[model samples]
Target: MANDTKIFHESWYRIANEKLCLRSSVKVHRQLFRGARWYVLSDPFNNQFYRLRPEAYEFVIRLGLDRTVEEVWMEMISAAPESAPGQEEVINLLVQLYQSNLLHYEMPPDSAKLFDRYKNKKQRIMKSNLLNIMFFRIPLFDPDSFLKNILPLIRLIMNPLGAILWLTVVGSAIKIVIDRFAEVSVQTQGIINPSNLFLLYIAMLLVKTFHEFGHAFAVRRFGGEVHIIGVMFLLFSPVPYMDATAAWAFRNKWQRILVGAAGMITEIFVAALAVFVWANTSGGLLHSLAYNMMFVASLSTVVFNINPLLRYDGYYMLSDWLDIPNLHTKATQQLTHLVEKYAFGYKRSTSQAYSLKEAFWLAIFGVLSGIYKLIVFASIIFFIADRFLLAGIIMALICCITWIIVPLVKLIKYLSSSPKLERIRLRAITVVSILLLFVVGFFYYFPFPNSFRASGVLKASEYFVVNSKVSGYVKKIEIEPGSQVSAGQPLIILENKEIDLQINEAMASLQESYAMRQLALAERPEDLATVEARIQAIQTRLDRLQHDREELVVKAEISGVWVVGNVADYLGMWIRRGAPIGQIINESAYYFASVIPEVHTSRIFDNEVKRASVKLVGQADTEVPVFRYVKIPMEQTILPSAALGWKAGGDVPIDPNDAQGVHSTEPFYEVRAYLDNNNGMKMFHGRTGKIRFELTSEPLLRQWWRSFRQLVQKRYHY
Candidate 1:
């Protein structure tokens, strides 16, 4: 017998004399886990599978109508004494097999217990479905027959040649996207537009359909059956899914891994095909639909499927690669094991991990997955609530109940009533109570660094808008755009033939008037006053014409960077009077103009700002110090710069009605933080960045409550 095996269990006498055998309908398959042989008991009727180690499998096979369970156990111990399972292990094995309907009892009345077990299993499944309301599934039909019919075709594509083709197509599609990256990026901003929602849903459906089919084909190609094809309501949106778990029975771990990754591979291929369609077509329903398909495929595969932290395709692949079956469940159990064994000081508590290395991985994965799940859940809730408040509220409530309330209730029950904690119950209770209190107190009392960030653009403290004083055509650009120029330097020269001609005519008239004035003075002293008046009028007109002609040359109003749009495009283009040609900013003086959400305005207004800093995009290391700030109390929808809107790749939500994208959808308070001039930082006008306001330290719970209150007030006006 193995040294680690328990000699006997107290409950062994109850099932010692019972005769049981493996059900005829349940098929057994051999597989390897972590280089150890394991037998998989597959129940064909229910499509359920269970794994059993060699020692347990031998004992199970020994069971028959004539032999008692104790006799079978004795035989198992005699055959493989070193690796035989203990009596407690035997009891657990039998209970699990009976619950799974993989065992049949000789006594007919014992069948009632089996029936009850099956009913309980069904009820548990129903409860699980209810808890996972956001991801509920409804089985539609069996796809085994359909998969068999398409097996040959699947084999043809699930090969090396198909892989080569996939690479070629996907590579070309990537190149196409890279070539027009800017246009594609701009188009992506409207992906969730109300007008395009229907098309987006359709594209998502198509991509997911192909993705499921890919799994089905892979399973069939690897000699596995895919029976259940269903619609999974992912966040209340129906998407097709298939049962590809039969691949778990495959002996080759690589085959199982391949099956897990097939869905994502298929999605990428679909995205590539959609990219081609989008690139080839112009503006139309087809082009838009293709773009949506590309978006859906890439988003689903990357953010959801390929993320190893989530229990999706990538997670399963990682599990198979690491030879960890039921990784999530085991990792969760490992966490519990740590709490009970170490935290509660329960020495008898068993670990779910097989080795120290595995325990470390399980611990790390468990913590990371839990955190990621919370982030994803919160993000989903916010996203849904932003669109549908009532639906989001309902989902949040249900998820809180299932994820938080239920687990807490279970933990309390375990601490109070579990038999294993009988000896250390008091200590365990005290430890858990302290932990709970610590967590609550920490959140409610501990002061954390409080700050809020807003997207802003750099602006000059004082700037001059260079405007044409007189209407004229631009003849030359004396100073290039983006060049530094001194004040009064000629920036552009304008030509106006009409103004020049007027000046010449006025001069000629003045000369003629002077000659007439002199002649009048000599011939008739009475006509001298009229001639003098005529000469004065002509001289005034000539002076005005000369001034207008001189105004044709535009000069810089300030000594700063000459910022203008395409100087070459403006050459020969007629500019009207008072039209803005360019802006000459005082580069030495700068300020950051940031828009604060109306809800968050109270934080800045009520509290004295401790400090503020600006971090420009692509220059994260440089912190520009803010000396003074000016807050515009009035809420306005106008953005200081278009770069702070969605259309310009900024984080602010823009108003669709405003074509220029400089208008925001919601009203915000504009805050201008004057930057330090002596910081040796060259700030550019309209350069977008984030400005963080350091406020008084506040507790996280208080901050959260304040945010929630503000959210309700802003969203519901309550």
Candidate 2:
């Protein structure tokens, strides 16, 4: 309900009796937001929409040629005094409508003023286009005729039956995709390769064309015209786009949402079809194309189209779903209202939100959008800079001017010249200056706790691997895995019948040679010496055979816990010479081996390490402290264990071709920190964990700058 008290500006009072009315060309549409009735005034010629409150809508509806603005105001006050807009609000509403070309005066308008307004609007639009050069659009032919021609053919599928069919196709595609997920994932990595760039772009174009058509067709299905179809230069790449603003006039929220969602739905359907093709077909050009289509379609739909942070299809869909039109503008207004009302003590500043819940959403969205825009813009600038340095620098400067400089200049202008700040300019300036100083001081002077974490694995200080000394068959398993065994303890028992037979034959030969030597000794001394030498050779051969037979049993070389991967599988199996049986890990002495990226090595060496702790992946609640540490100077591409690589579902990236997942894509410095074992932490040889090194406290701003520089260096090799 509007306040019954009538308040008007002195200037508004001068024009209170002026005759004004809504233009015949302007159309009004009723809408509801947060359970409150509101009206949307649209200028179809200009494709502009302005939302009005119930009281304002009532005032607009009451205006006519027969009654002056004063007459309408009096009649409104007499009818619904509690619900009628005050004189100040009435003047403001009329000004907004007139500015929007939605209102007309009884008197002839000044041609010079009208032309100046038109030129100013054009200049603003052109300036916006120039600022957003990365996403500038080039309008092509109208898509309405093309849509009309195809509307009849696709009209049948634009219904419930088509929805069911789409669901079925998507469901089947999902199953096929799941079955071949590994294959698809591997192929997706090649999409960004220079060799595949052409095909990838082609696929992207085709998919986006389909996407835009989906929007156009959906609008046409709902009795709306798609006047413009164009190519948007998104990040220097041309992608199809369409203007489906006719859906804004939709009365049904769901209809508007459907139109917004139709593009994504179409892209998903194309991706589904691509999935089927890619799954059934063997490796070839067609298969590659299909895969690229599926990749681009799915990726763009999720990352861009469906992301509500972007002003894309998902943004509109979300707006309609929440019954909040012009969500972005309203969110900005809410933020401005907060700053004015609380920060500047502008008590008269009214919130754009109808309720607390709406205010909360608007505030949250406002902050999120601002942050997201900055991140996205910065990322794009960096990405382009990495490739084309000079072009990237120019673009960055332009973006900085448009996004940062312009806004700051506008803010300064508002603070100095805005009429609303006239009464409390000094107070506002003092408050704003203090706030800015506080923020800068907090970021610069404050010492924040600094820590960096890296993935690592717990490894035994020493490991004793038990291997077979001779080729034999495993006859018995003596010890189970994880069992503590003493040095020379039998871990596995093996039997070899061939070695036993050889030993027996050598023993018999030795006995024969000894007997012959005795016989020769009686005949001749020289012959006896030769026979004795033969007997000695035979005896040595027999001794070697016996030693080989005794080597069948495998024993632990050190006292530690036995770790056998699959001891049961080796039972009764032929063991090759030097084949590993199991390992004896000294769990009492353990250390965490962490791989630190080469870029972060400077920070590690520069800062004094205050403390360190290790948290096992699964048991993250427990933190084991490091007693001592040693940094290895060597740069290596081979990961210490597969548990710390991408192939094994870990955070580090490794060569996919490596079967063991041990080969890292980038070289890293290894650091081993001795763990305190007194806590009786269950230590495994290759248990994956994260090791955090606490460094000396530093200002947050400095830390962030360091981290950002490190990121740039690592990603772009700058």
| Top candidate when judged by TM-score against the true structure | 2
TM-score of each: 0.84, 0.91
Residue runs of model 2 more than 4 Å from their true location after superposition: 1-6, 34-36, 64-67, 106-119, 378-395, 501-546
Q: Candidate 2: lDDT over CA atoms?
A: 0.84
Candidate achieving the largest lDDT = 1
In the predicted model 2, the residue pairs found to clash are none
**Candidate 1 — worst ten consecutive residues by lDDT sum?**
108-117
| Clashes, model 1 | 0
lDDT, candidates in the order shown? 0.88, 0.84
Residues 1-718 of candidate 1 have per-residue lDDT tens digits of 1123355887677778889998999888898888888898987677778888777888888889898988988987788877788887887788888777788886545434524545577778889988999899999999899889988899999999999999999999999999999889889989988899999999999999999999989999999998999999999999999998888788899999999989988999999999999999999999999999989988888788989899999999999899888889888988888898898898766676778899889989999999998899888997788778899889999989998999999988998899879999999999999998999999999999999999999988888889999999999999988888998899999999999888888888888888888888789889999888888888888888788788898988779889899987999999998999999987777889998988789999998899999999988899988999999899888899999998899988998778999889888999999987566766788799999999999999999999989987886676
Per-residue lDDT of 623 in model 2 = 89
Total clashes in model 2, counting residue pairs 3 or more apart in sequence or in different chains: 0
